[model samples]
Target: MRAPGKLVPVVLLVLALVGCTNMPPPPLVTTPPSKPPPTKPAKTSEVVIGVDGITGGYNPHTVADQSAVTTALGALLLPSVFRPAADGTPQMDRTLMRSATVTKYQPYTVTYELRGDASWSDGPPIAAEDFLYLWEQMRRAPGVIDSAGYRLIDNITARDAGKVVEVTFDKPYPGWRSLFNGLLPAHLLKDAPGGWDAALEDGFPATGGPFAVSRLDQERGEIQLERNERYWEQPAALEKVVFRRADQVGVVDALRRGNDQLALLRTDSVGLSLLGTLGNTVAVHTVPRSATATVLLRPVGEDMSDARVRRAISALLDRDALVATGTRGGPGSTLRAEAQVLSPTAPGYRPTRPGGVSSGQPELAQAEAALQQAGYTRGAGIWMRDGRPLSLVIAAPAERESYVSMARELQRQLVNAGIQAKVETPSADQLFTESLASVPTGQRTTGAVHLAVVPRPVGGDPATVLASNFGCLQGESAVAGAQPTNPVGFCDASVQPTIEAALSGAVPVAETLTTIEPVLWREALTVPLFQEADSLAVRPELTGVDVGRAPSGPFDTAVAWRRAPN
Candidate 1:
């Protein structure tokens, strides 16, 4: 009976619990949903720059291929032992070199210690072989740029498993810092199909700088560079860089439309004025280039064989008018050249002309006298010498409007002076390789023209420039290939000793220039008109567009360029 009562209480408890569960759950309780975390905007990492043109031969060491685009590419893709500082002096690149110091006095030894991590984009170590290759090529190559310092190198020794380089000079070279710039990748270029002449003609085989060539199209005039993943230094700020060829109007339009972020162009006064139209959207600056506008009278030509006739032509030239034509009243107009050996804007440049010859005005009376002295008689508005008409052909690069304009002006001036002359516009490559380069020994190729309005490369080592311009090819038995030296085909044996002295560092550069400039001018072979200038125009969204150094301009610090948020 007691068990039955307990079971009844248990059954009642169970029934009460079941009844509570059966009733609807008391008021569903929940917290409000939170808003999703706000997303952030992506940062920009690409930049597009406008350039005048894109010629595929990108070797910075060659006279024929030396241009703004070449310099820019070299700064982005090549490595150098020393780079130019803002003061225009050699400063060792800390990213590539740990230390570079003079170790010996007697043999004049210089020891360079490369950073252990420094390497080419393709994973090859930047070692002594690269230095050796550049030295061998520069000292021996016919058309290389500024090989004087390389020639002084007697031998190179490698140590520390190729991480250390020891250079032994035959004599003390104070300008040794100028050597080994834009070091090429020996592993790829040494045995390439075309050798030094054809090396980098298409694009770099390997890159040693912060950026590498991702795309290079010659016909389309576009070269795209991307951040080099193998670079050991700080990564470049921009992920992609594109060099696009465009004219002045196109560049202005692109900048306005945000298609281009920056532009480096060979500009005239009208070009500057057009840039001014952009107002606060862009900033423009004048960047002095390493070349000077010049007029060269090829003595190998029949009409210009006599120095007197050359002098007569020189006397008739209106340099001011030519400068105005070439510069188009731009900043270069203020850089009128006053010397044969150095550009007026170059450091230590001094006028070498006699006092009376300081003014660059047409001396019509002197021109007539010189023509008469040369036994040239005027007949039917043309000079005739030895029963031959004194006619000439003036040449200029077709791509360069300034050069073509200057050539046309010169032709008009010569025609007005009773000297029959015609203008010829040719491609820069053809003009440099065939018309300007020295022909091989025992073989002759008559150039298309006798007079050339060209850009003479300067602002390098004075000795190297002198040798490149006027010195005879010493020790070389024959001109086996195209030699971009002595373009006028005129050399004086008497000045050979002085040139050697300068190249050997025996005579100071200033003294050497002083001694030889007058002789060069008296020869009447070449006349420097003005220093050339390139303008860098930058859009507001693009930052870090500055003249990094004296020679290379903005490309020297291209790794620091960036695109800012609008």
Candidate 2:
């Protein structure tokens, strides 16, 4: 989901002004090839950014169509009530919202006040109806992507003639801040026939943020955003921003050629060797992203269904070695050996490596012993039980090249320990979208996917990720049904109370996470591999660049960016 496109209305206005000019035309000017007429110094205030690619349609709610580009665009153009700070704390964007307060605890209720001056670029007030519309779509629309926290809200109503919003919940929700981060204009979406899909696709709507989409060229894979005149806050520092599509090599080339000032590249996308070559030409910043690469064992009918088997697999793999190999031993490469879902950098996070699991040092003997105790014998360099080999299939998303390398490494380690394992690299759509749902009771499992190497972003609230991924009553638990984030079908009734307690603000977050971390480790639901660091190349003069926990990249704080003294 990237930003949508149309020619800027301002372009026409400039043309009309030129046509009505009364001054005599100036004489043509020319310069020799050796000394070209001083090209009116390219706007120093604007920033040109290069991204991986423009793949999905520009709709974040359209689950399957969302992409990193879409999330980035939303940060720039959409109306967000709260924006995450560098430390992953929610900061109220006073331009869009005045305040949000919890007025009641039991049958939880919240009151929100929107800025009186905040209105969409098209002249509609940013009101409670917009929040209500987003909530209704997320709760009712089947195609909507992530509705975890939104579904908890019971109702929302307008007060003070649409200036204030009052929301009531059926149960306590501590992660309320995560909801309604990006709100669509109600006037445009509420009455649309196709609902959100139609509204999001019918040209990006006029926005209320610091910037608005001025042009989107799909063929050239570029999007241009101009400062929003209707913005209620201090104006954005840059007058215009252009996002261009580029691969790893292209990103480096664009930066070197002075065509782009900023670019984000994955370590795997551009090898460490290539990054090192840039040297003094560009400054590399290792931004600690919230996402972590993990290995999820399917809890359905397979040898991996047994906790012992899963734990044994966890013990055998050398996560440090995997990270080293996958990242090419880069400067920021390190293993996320903690069994918990929270990133080490996140608040309330604690290291919890399961007692027996060897992260950097492989415990092949212990792994084999566990397999033997489970009624398996080594034969022909593979474990066999009752004339059947202990075979498993690991699925990796093809788009993430590092995951592919890690999957192969995992397969090799398993085979070395007398286990038959195979790695299958599938398209991102197939691995993330198609294979996320649980297999029906009487239906055949798709591809018999035994394990999946996936990445989950642990945003500002670690509790949100914990609840969304591991809670018994939510996510992809057998009881809660399947969701894309929780396809492993991990369910423990005992952990539900703690999860609910933490989410409802009844228990201390650290205490709840401390209680739940052990459960995840004991069940071997997921093997935390590493916290992926977002790599960015920027000109030395650029200032106020910050990579927050959101998936929107560094542009999450684009409004604050400026050029430093040269």
Candidate 3:
């Protein structure tokens, strides 16, 4: 037994030695330490907002580009000398402006001192050139929101290495704070492809606010904005903000799925119903827009060329009835617009409609009288002027529900008045930039758009609105050899001086409106119907969402928006 066991141990030992020699003794048999569990990627700090649709040409100063998205983008990316208060008064923006004061009375000079650190995102200081660019463009460009305040500027001189701006006006402008708002990047826009006419048609070249546009994907219907780290003021709280385009149903679905944190949509019956489905998860705010639904009778068209005929049409389409029809189930249902110069939501708004004017009941008699005075006779239940029937084309933006609804209502009213009107749905761009714009001096406008149901853009300044909606075209004054075109295609030479007086502070705005509004009403160019409204839906996760003080909707304080802890 000793001899066999000794032999077996000897055999095992030999095999083990052979294995150790080949495999390096089992690599010392040490246990490898475990790595810390993979860290979760830091969640992106972002807020996604659902919007109706994303269209380009984001210049907030132009009537063709007037939109809530344009206003919101302006508030987020552009710099302004003044921002509107809760009461719609222009308040100095301390972040970009140091002091803005009327330094002289003889020449009516306003001096603006900009913060030294204020600069655009692309390394250019926010300077007097920006002011001069806006002034020149507003004064010369057609289809601008308002140019009356800018047209008063006699000269603009720079000081303090372009940080201080000395603007001398031909007359004092009480609404000076409204000027130079949403300042453009002059260095980039001045020599760009389209200059003032086409500037910002795509996206901002440089930003002067708390957020900068990082991406504008039209195909994806998304606009991505990133915090402007170079901003002189406090940076935006969130790292990113996204505007996603969605229809009414898509908006509600996005909110339900927690995909969208906020939404600013045009108010409609269907949209309101859909948003109601979100229930307690979202807070719905009825945000009145800084615009009014108005019916414009363009004189350039043959049917509306006669002042009496225009008056007839204006009287036939009842304002109260249009308001009720256009604003049903919306926030503006109770906000009736009666002033052509200022919306009911605007500061210092006053009813400009002359007293003693009954509702549509009395207006029918007035319409009949005016139509007879214009030599229009009823034939086959349609008004006949010359040998042609008074069959006019009514145009409205297809995208806006209120405008389209109001247009249909207007058509009904005209039809009941023995007038024929055919409704046309065109994109807003075609309607504002082409159809409603004034024709060139030696040219004629080619369209059947006699009546337009459109949004009259209102602002903080009453005088600016007066001139913007009715001012005569000033051709080639700011730039040499440029053609002039009116915004509304209606101008009264007699009232032009009075409008200028209001814009220049020569006449008190309240007094000037009293005089000018009656003239506008008699001209029958525009009839105010109701205040426009927007609906904002916000999720509970959002902390700083508010209907901001600015007319730019709920994104005015977007820089301070934050998400609650998960």
**Each candidate structure's count of clashing pairs:** 0, 2, 0
Each prediction's Cα lDDT score? 0.82, 0.72, 0.80
Cα RMSD of all models vs. native, in order, equals 9.5, 14.0, 5.8
What's the TM-score of each model vs. the native?
0.84, 0.82, 0.85
Higher-lDDT candidate of 2 and 3: 3
Q: Model 3: per-residue lDDT, tens digit, 501-553?
A: 77777889789888877877787888777787878999888888778654776
Tens digits of per-residue lDDT for model 2, 165-220: 99999788877887787788788768878766566653476787899989888778
Residue 184 deviation, candidate 2, in Å? 3.4
Winner by TM-score between candidate 3 and candidate 2: 3
On lDDT, who's better, 1 or 3?
A: 1
Put the candidates in lDDT order, highest first: 1, 3, 2
